[model samples]
Every structure is written in structure tokens, then in C-alpha cells.
Target: MAAEALKSDFGGKAHIALNDPKLRANFRRAMDGLMTKRAAQFADADEWNALRARGAAVRARALAQLPELLERLEARCQANGIQVHWAETTAEANAIVLGILQAAGAKRVIKGKSMVTEEMHLNAHLEAHGIAAVESDLGEYIIQLAGEAPSHIVMPCIHKNKVEIAELFADKIEGQAYTENVDELTAAARKALRGRFADADAGISGVNFAVAETGTLVLIENEGNGRLSTTLPPLHIAVTGIEKVLEKLEDVPPLLSLLPRSATGQPITTYVNMITSPRKAGEKDGPKAVHLVLLDNGRSRVYGDSELSDTLRCIRCAACMNHCPVYTRVGGHTYTFTYPGPIGKILTPQLEGLDCAGDQPHASTLCRACADVCPVQIPIPDLLVRLRTEAVHPSATAGVKGGGSAQSLSESLGWRGYTAMYGSPLIYRVVTRLMGLFGNWVPASAPMLKQWTSVRTKPKFAAKSLHQLAREKGFSHD
Candidate 1:
């Protein structure tokens, strides 16, 4: 499925979860634990701010010379015996991956956690072609068996509780012991996946960063499945967005420094595998063939637009989502896309267009917390405002313009009136006094006032307006 299609389909179901206690508990426990760990990790790193700055600079430099870097990367990879393919769209990317699998005559495929593949819906597409795509990552494996899209970026099954997982394993795994203990369930999954990994004709994974200097692909994961996926199979395929590129090899350390700290609160992930090319002569168990598929899929459009270009700096550490109060309450499913949280809100609109992702920009609280916590310092709140403006005001060339209704006209007029009034204190005092007269009419329990009341009590209106009070106090105002 296309990214927008999947988002639309899943977003509808996320509403049903608002009343689900079990799911809410699952979300709260996992998210809270992860967030606490992340806070501790950041606290330990005294140079966290410095690391973020360096990471941002590296990504900015890479994006500035993306065309040149991609060319250099392609040449280096080819020289190292790794074939490279460019895909301009999701369908083309999926087709390229499937064609490669077909050429290898592969029947079964083992996959590590790769959100790019999820964005392209590569598994479903491959299944339609008679290939069994097995998810090797434990969380991904759980979600795949549940026939659901991932709820979180790094942790796919974050919404599933242990009992639910035990039930899933009981039904799926033949003769497996049914246990809710986390370790037992993980062991069961590992036992099941080990067979698939050994017998699979190919392995598929995602690239965290592709270094142009050495033509190296990096994968960061807590589980060793990423290592297994990249090494064990005879054929290895990596699918990633074009934004994953890094200009020079030295630029990697700062990004690596920031990612794990921001992501899961670890100083570094358990495994950070760097693959330069396919296994050479006398290699001890590595893929014989290696292919890297670089996906554009609307990223180029974002790069061209100055207002939204900062979104391309995302390393997908998912820190914005972790720190977002809105995401913590509503969860990733509410965004209903491959990528979720604050980053997802800005990114989905740019990738899928304003019309397709209408709910995303409005999803934020505009608290600016996400922007403050972002590792790469993408002005997420500012971008969201830009997207909301575009959503509310479609282009005149689109035929159906925005300002057609009486309500919209009134809103525009009200904004203009407020702007003019606020420019002069005399007019502002007049409006303020006028509003004070009607303040008593506003009900304490008004639904429109709930959000304000939730945070603070409504201020008692003064018996006299500021103008009257000033006059009573004998304060002369020209």
C-alpha cells in the first residue's frame, strides 16, 4: 500500500482505541519506561547539546550536496561490488526489490526492522507474488503476526501487552510454551525466527546511514537480528530513504552519539553494523550479493521547498514523538502513518501532500515542546504552522480556493480587526472593555472553554473596564 492509503485506513481505527483500557495501559507503560530511560541518558551526557549541534551540521552539509554525494556513493558501492538502484516512487521501489528477489529465485525472505519497507508496503506486495517475508525483529515479528501496522517507529509492537503477545504466540507457534514472561516470549520468537533466517533465500534490512566516503551502510539496533539479516542470507537488500546519506565517514560519530541517546536512552545501541559491500573471497558467512535501493518517494519535493526542507534532517530517532505530550496521550496510531509523532506530523504532509494528510498538522498542541527536544533541531512547530496555513488556504490556481464561506469570511475579518486593534493601545482598550461586558455571559462549563479551564481558571471580569478604571483613578490618557 502507498503511505497515504495505509495512513487513511489505520487512522479510522485509532479512534476506536480511545475507549480501550488494555491498549491504553500498554501504551502508557512502554512509553513511560522508554521516556524515563531517555531522560536519564540525556542527563548523563554533559555534551548532549554539542552533539546535537554537530549532528545537525553534518546532516545539513549532506543535504546541501546530496546530488554529488549520491553519485560518489554509487561509484564507491559499484567499485565494492554492490549494485545500487534509484527509485523515484514507492511502487517503483517495491518493484525493484521484488524484481531483485525474483532474479535470485528466492521463495522466503527474512527482514530486519525497516520503516522504509513499511512505507512502501513491500511485505504485502511480495506476499502477493508468492514470497513469504518473515520479520526477524521481535517487535516487528509480533506485529506482522497480528496483521497490524507498527504503532511505534523503533518499537513496532509497543501497544501490545505481554498477555496479548502470549496469546498471539500461542496461536502462531506450533507446540510452543504459552507464557507471558517477557524473556520466554522473546526466546520463543527467537527460536521461531532462527529457522526462518537459516532457510531464507534472502535478507532485507534498512540503512540508518549510508556513508559516501567508504560506500558503507550502517544499521543500529538493540537486537542482533539486524546483524543476522545483513549477514546470514545469500542475498542482502537494503531499502532506505535518500535522506539517510552522510557526506563523509567522520560525520557518522556525532550522529551515532545522538541517535541511541535520543531513541531508547542507551549510550549506544547493542549492535551498529557497518557493511561496505558484499562478502569478498573467503568471507565467513555474509551475503554473496548486496543491493542498495535508494527511495525518493516525494522527498525531492520537500528538498525543493525552502519552508519544509528542514524535515529532511530527520534521522528517525523518534525523540520528537517520545517527548510530545500529544503523542504520549493519543499514541502513534492516531497519526496513522509509517512515521508518527511530531516528526510524522510535518513529514506526512510534505510526503503525501496537504490534501491527503489533513489531520496531521492540526494534531499538535503547538506547545513547541517537540522543537525544543528535537536532536537535529528541526523547527517542527514552525513547519506545522506553515502546513496548517497551506491546509486552510489552498492555492488560487487549484480552482477551489479557501475563502468561500461566511464562517471563513468572518474569521478572516475578525483576524484583521484584531490585528488593527492590537496595533494601537487606544483601540485595544476599547475592544477589551467591550469584551469584558460580555465575559459574564460565558458559561463556566462551556465546551469551547474547556481547554483553557483545564489549565487555568477564567479570570474574573472587572466591574469596570480598564478605561473606566483608569478614569476613576484620575489617570490621564490623551
Candidate 2:
């Protein structure tokens, strides 16, 4: 695992993702099934909307008092025998985790599916330092062996069909043969990872929700890996973004009820683990030392911006991405970040900077389908537009938005020309007349103009402009 993770080079990723036919088919099948399941679970529309609104309110309130809540959580975790560490950036988070592992004298680590680790490029870092970090989640294991990142948040290998997975297992796993059976594939991965679980010196996991009232980390998953990762090892380290915190234990239920259902359309996932602390005095199982790393990584800055703070409310349910036309076409990897789809567009610029992530906000069609399905009721489309504005006009942000290297003299000039023509009726009429008269004569060598003519011939423009014809026909009240 080289540190050169899929490169945050956004300019060419969408083009590559769009052209991959096999990936497109895989997404189409996966998305259709997920949408069907989601629809079935929410047969009563009113109940769904009510729950969604509650989730939004709870998240907004928690974020409003985040600083106080985090301090409270740290104090409470210490009271429960759990050590908590704060990391302001990905590098700081990685360094803290590595230092903890080294202090425990751990060389082999087993992991549950955690996107924060992916964001930090933790596996590559650990590999470079001679630590073997093994991914135990089936889909995570599949992609790890393939040397590829997870294409979807909920379904990591959603871009790969059973056939592709079968092929990957046959090629990567020793003595394994090719088979497209789903159960067999899962069984193969389970067998391969079970040994790592028993032998791992330490375990790593991700937190879905952190309840500040009781100082507990909540995890939701279908498979049993998350449970094993926390309890089986001598030491456990949980990593997550600071935004995952909740104010009280009671606050977790409303968000939890919606989280699994929103994410995978199940009434409840098979496994939900709540870790309040490490093994106490005489506990037979659970880690001897439990640590929680709360990562800021530009999140505190995002929280400071009133317009973008709503982005922090996301529970990683990913309902927005499921309904997004752009995400459906290009898949997650096209965004070239750990969090992809609608969430990625707003969050990536903050974490990776606009210089690397500038193209994501522009990829949207502004269809607003994502906003409609978001369980937390985050106004994703509005945030997207604000990000675009920040990119094109950085000074407007007042440093509230992330980095932006989007200033372009030529594009700005083109917008000025559009305004000049469209803002005045006489200029608009003249411009239309000139284009209608000589647009075809402008040679095909003019590439930008050729784009317009390619779909529309010069003769398509009528002798009379649309305005003149409308006036003649008495359709214009003006």
C-alpha cells in the first residue's frame, strides 16, 4: 500500500469513472436495489419525514454547543477509564495512533471498516512503518487485497460485481479458485480474516456516534467484525471525526433509528456495539486499554461557517449519494476522496483544499435530488452553490470557506460578455441578429463556436429573431 492514494486529482477522475462500463453496471444494479429497499422501509411517508426533522434538530443543537460537548465527552471518557486524544489534522491523528501502537509494542493490527482511517491514509502509513494493518470487514478486505479504495461508503466494493470479486479472490487468495457465488465469496473472506482476528496484537475501529452524557462510542454494522475488533484485542483504538459527538445518551436513539435504516434500509443492523470504556477490574473480555482519537482536520473550521455547518450533521447515511445523478454516473472514486457523493463535494474542499478538490462542486447539475433524500435535512444543493461561489470568488468567503484557486480571467470575461448582451434588450437583439446572419460563416476552425453549431446548424436560426416573431404573433405583452 503506497501512500500515493488514488491522488486527489479530481480533474481527470470523473472522465475515467464515466468511461468504465463495468463499474457503471455495478453501480446501476446496487443503487436500484438500495432504492427499492429504502422505498419499502418508508412506506409511511409522514413517519419518515418526522424522524428526519428530529435528526436535523438534534444534530444542529449538538453542533451549536460542540466545544462544550467535546470537553464534557473527554472528561466523561476519562471517568469511564477510556483515554481520549484530540487531533487537529490527519497527520496529527495518524501520529497519535502510531505512537499508541508503538507504546503497546504492537506489530500486527486488525481493523473494522473506518472511513477516517482511509481519510488519513493510515494503512499506507502503518505499512511504511513495518506494521501490518489488516482490514477484517469483508468488503474492506476485498479492496485491500485489490489495492483499490472503497468506491461507496456503505457498500465499499459496490463498483465490483460478484464476478469481479470472484476474480479478485481467485487471483489474490492463495489456493482459491474463481467462483461467482456470493455466499462462497463472503465465506472465503471470512475464513481468511478469522486468523488475523485471533492473532492481532491490537485492534482498530471507527465510531458512528459518540454519546457525551455517558461517554460511549457507538458502532453499527451488519457483520461481526466491529465487535471482534473492539473486544478480542488487548488494546483498541477508535478513530472518528469530531462531528460524530452527541449531547446525551437519549440523543443517540433518534439518530441511530434513522442511521442504519437510512444507510442500508434495514430496520436495524445485526450488530450495534456500545463501548463506554476498556475492560474494568475483572472483565473476562474487552481491550485492556481503550483510546478514542477525536479528529478535527478542518472540521472545527467548517463548524465556524454558518452556511456550511449543516454539512457536519451528516450521519454518513449516504442517502444523498444514492439519489444523486452525478454520483450514479461517476461512482464514488471519481470524487477522489474517502467521503464521496454530495457529502464529498462540501467536505473535501475543507480537508483537501479547493486546489485539489475544486472540480467536485462544479460536477453537480443542481438537480436537488440529494437534498430531498437527506435524512438530516441538510441543504446540500445550497451548500454546493456556496462552495462554487467561494471557488470563483474567494474573497467573498472572508476565509469562512476552504481554499480556492478557481479565479480565471477568461471565464470571468465570458460571464461579463453574457451580462452585457442579456442585460440590455437592444444589445440582445443586435447580438441575435449578428449571430443569425453570420454564425454559420464563422469557420469550423473556431472550436468554441463549433460546439454550438455541432448540435445546431446555422440554418436552424430563423430569418426573424424569436423576439421579433413573438411580437408579430402578439405573444409578447411587452
Candidate 3:
């Protein structure tokens, strides 16, 4: 498909995704495998519930004191010799990173997998400024080479199969032969990225958790790339949302216990990197200068609402996506945002404004599958309904960004008529009788029924009212 053919809206993109057999098969296979793995990891129901409760409590505590914890984190990080920068928006975040790189005269950077960077569009910003940012995470590297956004948060290239990847590697990687062998393909990528890690002027990454008490930036990955990106270069810069802050280092274990098991069904990842500060004078093999960029990017708005604050409890586990029927079918690209699936449906609208992403809330089937699988137990279905209500009837305090932007006069009037008919007994009876007289006469092509009838049969209305039948059958209303 041409770039111009791609649609920004959810419906258009979903239509394209649903029709593509290859894409559907790729996502179905990936989702099923992930679901099975995650289910196996949490086989004991009692253990799963207890751990979920503990993790939720830990996140709730952190978010409750978010402001104080963030301030304390900055102080502790500064005391530990880690420079901290704060940005209210993605643009500011980009500029802060650029200034840090420019100050160090860094023209090349190797990156660890960070969804926040994707949200910031950091690579494009840096490239436009004449700096090169190379993604070191294998999945990230693959999609970056293909000039595509991540289709899944935990697995960026989940939309493509090995054969497509073989083609991509063959075409994009110089002198690389087409091979569907997973190990060989991985080796090829490692060979290509080894030089970038050693020669890059700086490294950039995303923090999984930032402990306020000890001032540590924690990142977990199955691959060693995250470690190399943060340690191999002389300069390292980490960017993350402010919501990632935790009140204490002790709170890490409960969340960590659930994160990997929920994400990829692993007991533990291969590498867990924790950076307390920059390299000391005698210290070797670490960045000499370390910087942390804390980005708000509308997270504060999400945090402001007590009901919506649950959204921040997410630990970036893709378990919700893996279990979501809608997401599994349409894939992440259909969401057309940095985050996708149930979490994205709620998070994207608040971050980007409902005027841009109002349709996302309505995309769900409200199956509650996402909520059931969420590691933190976020009530995704409830939040979707909340956003839907905010669209037509905005809060008086201007709570949600672009609230009420989806409202339409015709829809509002139709709803009003429905309310009136349902509220009045006489009106209901008269409308039902009239409908029984002429409802079936309404054609499938009628303006209101056309879209509804596309996949479903037109509902036939009875010629006689139920009340009339009851009277004829000698049944009293009592």
C-alpha cells in the first residue's frame, strides 16, 4: 500500500487491517502464542490474584505521592550526579535531548527500546537536526530500518512474519542474504549494530522504573542491547514519562515479579540494568555524563483525575494487548498512535485530545478481556465508557482534553427523541404501534439502517403490538 493510502482514523485503518490476510494471520499467531505463554506463567489462580493485588497497591502508592516522589527523585538523582531535566510536552522533551547532544557534540546515538521515545518522535527530531539515532533493540532496529512505527509495545515487529523480515533484511542490510532462520537473522542484525554501539558519541534509553529513594534508573530486557546502549558510550541520556517514578526501591520487586511474566512469560529477563549515577573518576565502562529527561506530555492531565489515574498504573506489559480480541484482529497499526490496544484506547485520547482520538474509545467490544489480563488490574472497560460519555457530554471543569468534540447536533437530537419516547408511557405506546404499522416498510438502504444492515440483517418489526396480542389472548396487564 502507498503511504498516501494509509488512513489516520481508526475505522479506515481497521478496514485495511481486517482485509489483509497476512497481517491478520501474523497478529493471530503472535497473540495466541503470547496468551498461552502468559497463561502458563500464571497457572496458579491464587498466586496470580495475590500478586496482582500487591502490584496494584505498589503502583497506587507511587501515584498517590507522584509530585513529591518526582521532586525527591530529582534531588536524589542530582545528589548522585545524574542531571535531571523536565519537559512539559514532547517538543520540549525533544529540544532538551537535542541540546544535551549538541552540547556534547554527539552526532550519533544508539538507543535501547523505549516507547516514550516513540511517543516523542525523538528519532525523527534528531535526524532532522542532522544527528543519527540508531535503535539497538532487535525489533526496534528492524522496524526502524523499514521506516515503520511499532505495532506492539513489547514486540515492535509483531505484525510481520519471518519471511517478510527475511525480505526486509535482504533489501535493507547491505550484502545480507535472504534467510528465514531466526538465529541467523538475529546474528546478522547484531553484526550490523555492533559497530554503532562502539563508535556512537552518545546512547539514549527509556527508564522502566526510577526509584526516588535511591535515585536509580532501572531497565529490563531479554537482550544485552539495553546494557550496551547505556554503558558502551561516554554519554548516556534516558527519557521517560514522569509516571514511571516509584516511591522507594523496595516497591520494585512486586511490579517486577509481574512485568516479565506478564510481558513475555519469562521468570526474569536476561539483563536488568540499574544506573545510580555517572561514572566516577576511577570507575570504568559507564557513561561519564548521564542525563534524565522527565516528560509530562499530558500525563499530568491523566493523573489529575482520580478515576483516570488508574491508567498510570500500567507497567507497559503487553498482556492486555495479547488478550484483546479487537487488538488481536486489527493489530496496533490500526490504532495509529504510539500506544495501542485497550491501554491505547484510553491513554491516546487523553494524551492527544479526544478531537483526534475520540473514535478509539468506541473501537472496543467492552469484552473486559483487557481488564482481566492487565497486570495492574486497570479497569479498561470503565475508562472507555468514561471517555465515551465525556465526548458527548463534557465535564463542567474542562477535565478531558478536547472533551465534547465528537458531539453532533443530529445525534444529540436523535438521542433526545429516544429519551423522550422511553420516558413517556403514551409516547412509547404510540411510537411502537406506528413502528409496527410501517417499520418493515423501511428499506435496508434507508439512511439510518444502511450502515447497520451492511453486515447484519434488517430487523423485522411485528405487524401487531405485543399489547394488542396480549389483549386478544385474554391476558390481563393487572
Would you list the clashing residue pairs of candidate 3?
none
Best-first order by TM-score = 3, 2, 1
Q: Which candidate is the best by TM-score?
A: 3
lDDT tens digits by residue: candidate 2, 224-303: 99999999999999999999999988888888888888788899999989999899888799999999999998888887
Backbone N/Cα/C clashes per model: 0, 0, 0
Predicted structure with the largest lDDT when compared to the true one = 3
Residue by residue across 369-411, what tens digits does model 1's lDDT show? 8887788989999988877776767534322112121135656
Candidate lDDT values, in order: 0.84, 0.87, 0.93
How do the predictions measure up, each by TM-score? 0.86, 0.92, 0.96
lDDT of 3 by residue, 1-478 (tens): 1221223499889999999999999999999999898999999999999999999999999999999999999999999999999999888999999999999999999999999999989999999999999999999999999999999999999999999899999999999999999999999999999999999999999999999999999999988999998999999999999999999899998889899999999988898889999999888779999999999999998888899889999999989899999999999999988899999999998988888889999998999999998989899999999999999899876489989997888778878999999999899999999999999899999875687898799999998988889989999989
Clashing pairs in 1: none
- Model 3, backbone clash pairs (residues 3+ apart or across chains), number: 0
lDDT of 1 at 148: 92
